[model samples]
Target: MLRVAAVKSPKIKKIENSPPASPPPSPVQLARAEENRIIALAKLHQSRTQGLFVNVGPSWMKVLEPEIKKEYFQSLCKFIASERSKHTIYPPTDEVFSWTRMCTLNEVRLLILIQFLFFSVGLCFSVKPGVQRPPSLANMYQELSKDIPEFKSPDHGCLTGWASQGVLLLNACLTVRASQANSHKDKGWEKLTDAVIKWLNSNRSGLVFILWGAYAQKKGSFIDQKKHCVLKGVHPSPLSAHRGFFGCHHFSKCNDYLVQQNKKPIDWNMLPAELMKENINIQN
Candidate 1:
């Protein structure tokens, strides 16, 4: 015990010589940072809201990225908190519901793209889910066809035009209408007619214009000149038969002309054969 040497004291570094380390950001701090970024972007541009449809932005897309899933969470919060969340665009019908499920499972982006495109063009705008049309486009279509006996066929309506084609389809329809508009005054019939004609004149060629019914026929003069071929005569309404609008042979003639010009056969048989037969029978 007496032989023990004095223990040497450990050298300690002076506090002034020590290096400082950065502090970690708290969760609250990180969340606030993200919110600030999103808010700043939202201020730069606000998307338009149609009935039930919400136009998502690139920021929203970024938020959905798996790495930055926080953005998605924030977007969901914003969307759900917004008044538009309560709306429903689809019907209760099992068929439409089933289609919606299928679209969700397969082509969510495609469906959203379509709605966005439609909103941009000002046609068939979406409403909030579950919100019914006051006069409803369907009701309006029914009313419009009420007096037109030829439009008695289930498929012979405006809604059919909306349902059968993509959002861009209406553009084709409108183009056909515009090419025929001789003057600004002719634009008075309906905005859609004017839009169609304008679109057609700008994008000519490779477009097939179907001019059904007397109204379309009367206004189809310009389209007749511009299109590869215009299928004219009665509107495929059942009344077309009694009105002598069908069996003009223009349908087949136009199809054949298109084949000759384009070096390809026109598939006028896109619709069900039975529907085609019904149209032909009514016309005859």
Candidate 2:
């Protein structure tokens, strides 16, 4: 009983605390993201490669007909043989069969046949110019001259029916070629359109597409028309300015639009008054 009366319990204070925060994303999460990015890149590359084969392969095959006859088959055989000496890179069954097939074809006969067919058509046209007439070469040249006035020689005053300025501008600024009726047949055009679309998708930027003629207008429809600002007009024939293809008052408005956007003008030397006014507006 000596000090029991004065003994007292120590007071305890409860420490208030916040819950533990989640740890930063672990190394595993970072590695997974990297893996996904690599897979995406691989898929994109595969898609591009397949697209190239589908659009361009047949045209390339036709163009390479000569090379195929002379050296391609033999070269493939040699490469396969070389690869076989090392560990097999290609399937053995497929390689052996393909090599055997290549060696059996009569290359010389095929070449002669193609050459004969080409010359025979030339001979037939020359012999029967009237009854079996395809368009005359001279008439064809004349029509082309009309379509492209720049073809007029210096001695020729203006080539009677041709429109000079419009043809010149069109040729200089835009290339219009005869494409196959089937859009799929124009591989170069397809590839260019595909690339532009891909770039736009990735960049999320606005694009302006200028279509100069009916043909181009039709082709533009195949693309993602909504994604870009498309400006369509006639073929820029000399008549276009008078007919108000886009607008007579602003014949060169497209050029002005481009310049204001910090883009290059279609033709700097031929800047119309409307374009100059736009330029002044931009400066002010």
Candidate 3:
């Protein structure tokens, strides 16, 4: 038996008082950690989904410090937010799929530009990725060209073919709410719209701008009339279709302009083929 020290050593006192090293996170703690991981992954997937055509937030969000990452994640989530998630507005990372406004090797003269307020329907992507247009917009596309005037979920191939052949579907506001009612009302939208218009107007000309309705027509004001063909009319909404939209003969007129410009007319029929039959690329 060791003799008791007149006074306990400071070392012994420290050891006894320090308290047992906190046990490794409890089973409960481990479970909570796993749950957090799952949540993080889900949030990332949502961001990527909303991004469309481009892999925006998900891929890189992991590397940022927690605070900064939260900022962007919250921003991107705003467009897709439900009543619970809406917060600060953030710029979108993806674009609706399309070729550059200035495409070369086109079998045509210049791109036919169709302007919209914003993407009325969210762009859908899959392993075989593509965009899904709203019903009215789809009808507008069919009216422009094609025999069958309908498709369920339009694919990327349709858009790719149009871009490849010679069409630029430009939206005045590039990003909008997932909800249609308040779609492009946010303050950031017009700033984005101005940038896109400026880009199109800069170092480009002779583009055919199809400005349907008052809003799209207004968006075209900055585009030089000397450089582009501004085809304006009532919008393609069911409400406005009767207001000089039906039988406006825009498709034929667009082709006519292209032909007059000495550039090959776009194969409007191509989109119909690609949209209805996903496996095929639209040709002639």
Candidate 4:
């Protein structure tokens, strides 16, 4: 064996020039990064509002039930974020996923679900989740008040008042573009809302569900009619409200069912004391 000297390779110095500034992120990549950021923010919003929300939407939102913290809700939030960043148009208060927090979670005896955030009126007036005074809502208040007399008419503060009485007001499709109906349909919101409905039907007993319109009624099909009361009616939209919504009497019917179930009836006349007084005076 001939002795051979091994040549050592020269050591090259490492050069780090800030990694080319990441190529300034291509348009597609910038778009993707933005999408990821949106998703992260949406997820963060969900996390921050979890377990008895710490100031998410309004005073009402702060007291939302623990449902907001569930896995289904988190998944929905991520999907919504991703979808919105891609193409879906979100409504005004993207943070308020559902109109929950009428009362403690356990106190909820009824769930009211509509198809989507009916934004027909939202284009004209800013919709502040718990404070929206759309014509449809006003019609509901009017009709229900006419029937029950105690159910207060729609005023500036009546929306929150109604929510504070333990009715979980939810929309199957949570968001849509302004003036566009069901624009956000099939965008993964149904799963979350459906899960909420199913959870209530299974875990809780003697609950009342008011499923307005064909879409909500369809989504509510899985509810066990044997365990809960499911009330179906035409949506209270101006287009079809005259067809059946006017006489649906869902408010009284919901209260009646609650009584039958031995649950305290939701006082549909949920106006604050002062507002109630003013309302009465106006009527007088």
lDDT of each: 0.32, 0.30, 0.47, 0.61
| Candidate that beats the other on TM-score, 1 or 3, i.e. the better one | 3
What is the TM-score (0 to 1) of candidate 1? 0.33
Off by over 4 Å in 1: 1-49, 52-189, 224-227, 269-284
Clashing pairs in 4: none
Per-residue lDDT, model 1, residue 14, is: 78
After TM-score superposition, the amount by which residue 131's alpha carbon in candidate 1 deviates from its true location, in angstroms, is 22
Error of 3 at 65 (Å): 24
What local lDDT score does residue 9 receive in model 4, on the 0 to 100 scale? 97
TM-score of each: 0.33, 0.26, 0.51, 0.63
Give the best candidate by TM-score. Answer: 4
* Cα misplacement distance, residue 277 of candidate 2 (Å): 31
Per-residue CA lDDT of model 4 for 164-254, tens digit only, reads: 5667767677667655777767755677567667767877899999888888888888899999999999887788889989988888899
After the best TM-score superposition of candidate 2, give how far the Cα of residue 127 lies from its true spot, in angstroms.
34
Off by over 4 Å in 2: 1-194, 197-206, 222-228, 237-251, 259-267, 270-284
| Better TM-score candidate (1, 2) | 1
lDDT of 2: 0.30
